[model samples]
Target: MSIISMGTHLQLLIHPSRSPIPHRGSLLQVADHGVRGHRHVRAHIMAARKAIEGVSDELNAVASQNMDFAPARRRVRTAFLPVQQQLNHVLFKMAVPEIQMEERYEKSSRGVEIFWKSWRPGQGEPMKAALFFCHGYGDTCTFFFEGIAKIIAAAGYGVFAMDYPCFGLSEGLHGYIHSFDEMVDHVIEQYARIRGMEEVRGLPHFLLGQSMGGAVALKVNLKQPREWDGVVLVAPMCKIAEDVTPPALVLKALAIISNILPEAKLFPQKDLAELAFRIPQKRKMTAFNAISYSDQMRLRTAVELIKATHDIESQLEKVSSPLLILHGAADKVTDPQVSRFLYDKACSKDKTLKLYEESYHSILEGEPDDRILEVINDIILWLDSHSTLK
Candidate 1:
């Protein structure tokens, strides 16, 4: 019976006079054995302590070499671009007419740098209309929307998209949404800049939003009631579907934690790639989306998304733009029934709602090739009808 107390020296405490102590060995022998055991334990402990201290010193030296986070972020973006280009090439076929692309960086009112890109058909073709896109949560324009933009551009319309702050190659910590209002303001500011371009000045402008982007588009239209000629929402997150949101007790816990650890990625949510795409192969391709923020949901971002949806639902009547709401009937990400709710309650007289049976959230990108083309054709026809001189 020996107890080893670990400290500067290993102290072995032995009770030599316990009841029923007639054991296999004498008390002096036991004491001798305990002394040897403590010595062995002390030697191993000293060795481990030295090893840990050496590793700690090495880690500190490595960390000191790069204290600035910005350059590390840039390195990550550089690696991501090659993957983005490869995926873009596989997705956007050159068989479609020649489309000229322009990429640029601009600063938001809040001083966050945003990455933006646009596509337009070449060959001296005049732009019929401008389609500005807002990507969904954890999605970047460079990867998923590359093909969608090409399709819209080949259809004789100029396509534009902005990677929001903290998303894609944009500046700020990734997957952190400080405030939903700030996000809405940033989108409006970027699109307003695009709308002011000399080439697109008088052309009709349409806002295309997917999932979380839908909430942004709605808020933008609400902010400036008559600026947009039309708006397209794909599974707009008006309200979080009951099935996907956390339980009441859990949400209450999150609400409290958000105030203390706003940026902490403590919220647990499903990996959206599995839930958003229906096809198994297409779902697997999402693994290579290098610039996406696929980490655990951040506390502030998740709470803001919930708050934004609630706010959007309350003011659905104020959404005055000509609306085209497309939803997947089986979408578990955002409720299709909510799209029906928006169509029923929205004040827009030209609102149209199309529910694709058995489709998932990524209707334009993740659907079958035929379905993707069909969705694109529908969008083009809508834009063509609305863009005509009226």
Candidate 2:
């Protein structure tokens, strides 16, 4: 029999002398398989064993209880997901510092920083009409347009897409919430201020706002007003049904809680990362693997995205610009009702609602590239027809 010390390096004895031990597991054995990430847990156990074994193994009853802290760990994870989503929403969209997207640049304003890409046609000198793109929450606009730039540019429009503040090549900060009025009045004004070069100020301008940007475009095109050829909104998140509580609420709640407890973890993305906005018609490609990791889509701190959502029912009457609301009938993100609502309610004398039976939330960049191209051509044709008519 051997005696072991309690506080110093573990003492090893040749024989066991205990009649009964509370923590009766073997000194070198482990229960349950390893966690996916902490593959080195066994090593950690072995390393700590040299120091902790000195205490009577009975004490391990208390230590083991502390080891399997499932409830506590769960609470910790629950809190972390939201905050992480916010930071990553900006980081994942930008240059990523570690992995570079095709085209990247930084722009700053109002103590805010953003990243953008001004993709011109590779074949021609330049385009007369400009396609301004605004991305949704937690998405990089450049990535959304990745391989489709040539198709869009070929249609005689220079594509200028931007990652929202705190995303992509933009700066590092929590997501910034923008009111519809602010997006149109302030954000677009920021674009106009820098865009007002004598040579290009008078060019045909068209705004393409997707999801959150759609709401922004609607507000901007209506109030501030732009003499653009037309406005195209794809799957704008104007009105989300009550059945679905968006992550935006999590972001907002985090903003409030984080103010009080700066270090408190806000885990909104846990659910979002698991969700995917798929079109049920034939199934299309989504940017994030929603099926496998639905929470990944919720990778953004949703407060800003949430704030961008507004019911423009009364405001729709104010928009005078020609509008195009393109929505996927089977989108898992924004509902077709939104498209129906916009079409039935918009007062634009020349409003068009094109519902693609096979398209999803990412109408332009989903599974079948050819179909998206067709939509683009249809847009150009409509724009040309309207231009000729006017």
Candidate 3:
């Protein structure tokens, strides 16, 4: 998440002052009513900080451990699930009362229990199109996306998102990826069902991805070129930034070790939240994402990510879906140049790229409320323009 100066919209909701937690209803009231000229918003931020701090030590301890297996990671997630849901941020607390949300667990073709979610306009609202989400590495669709999906749904689109097997509420080794291609197949399978749903059938379908998930979306489009109408990429990992990638010798060593102990949590990694979020308050809030994979990269996961990016880089010309690529020019996690490369290489004649100057990797979640809304509005406008409803 990247930082930005607090805009008027955020000033109404967050203050640097420290205070005790306010009542949950009061916090919601302030958000719903757009209340200003009070300390309630400050109280809310301080309260959230307290809540996150209360659990940080425990979560950090768990993250520091050698959680090479699914059970260990699952245990930590289960233990902190309730705490995570209660933590608040500007995005999470934003009110979108006109949208309906649903969650369920389904058995995938590979027998993994997948956790999927949907956000749609209220029953009587007009339906326009469908947007399927692909979340970034170690991130869950259930966190910051709740507010984002609701905003999109309120704009007359059906928004669908899912936790990949082994991530979030999905059943599998937590934070483990045996094969990146198989994961993409699972996403394709689940989305195929959602596309066929009665509510969204026959509507334009778009794929939206962030960071590593950007790579996943591209792979999905490559595998089923005609299935999607367009693709939206946010700071996509077409190629990992050289600053984040390990030294070539270290990468080679990790690749060799992965074959022997694929799940070992030994690969070194920097604090991504620090690098990705520009806002100090927002970066601090990342601890509230209790289920995100924050430990050392698992040996196999690292190798698979490297291989996936390489594969996508070589096949960029095959991406034929209408494309809208958005990247933060200052993003350190994923190279913005690669997004430009993708824009130049994709075969789709209808493609666009918008680069936000001074923004960081987590553009939607970390940027100021004004900037965040700008990006969301940009996306909604693009969707409206491309949809049959327009």
**Winning model by TM-score:** 3
Across 196-304, the per-residue lDDT of candidate 3 in tens digits comes to 8888888899999987788889999999998899999888878654444445675676677666666655433334555577787877776656566654445577678
* Cα-based TM-score, every candidate: 0.78, 0.60, 0.79
Question: For residues 189-228, what per-residue lDDT tens digits would candidate 2 score against the true structure?
Answer: 5557536755346667777777666776776676556556
For model 3, the stretches where C-alpha displacement exceeds 4 angstroms are 1-51, 54-88, 241-254
The TM-score-based order of candidates, best leading, equals 3, 1, 2
Candidate 2 lowest-lDDT run of ten: 13-22
Q: What is the C-alpha RMSD of each candidate to the true structure, in Å?
A: 17.6, 18.6, 13.5
Question: Which ten contiguous residues of candidate 1 have the minimum total lDDT?
Answer: 41-50
> Can you write out model 1's per-residue Cα lDDT over 1-390, one digit (the tens) per residue?
112122222211111000000112111111111221242111100001111121245432332222112344445556545544544333554367888999988888878888899999886999999999988776678776787788889889999999877776677666678788988889889999999999989999999988778888888888988789999988787765444445556557666766665665543333454456777666655644534554445567777776777788789998878999998788765668889999998998899999998887778766777777787788999999999944
Q: What is the lDDT of candidate 2?
A: 0.46
Give the per-residue Cα lDDT of candidate 3 at 388.
68
lDDT of 3 at 60: 56
Q: What is the C-alpha lDDT of each candidate?
A: 0.68, 0.46, 0.72
Q: Residue 202 in candidate 2 has what lDDT?
A: 68
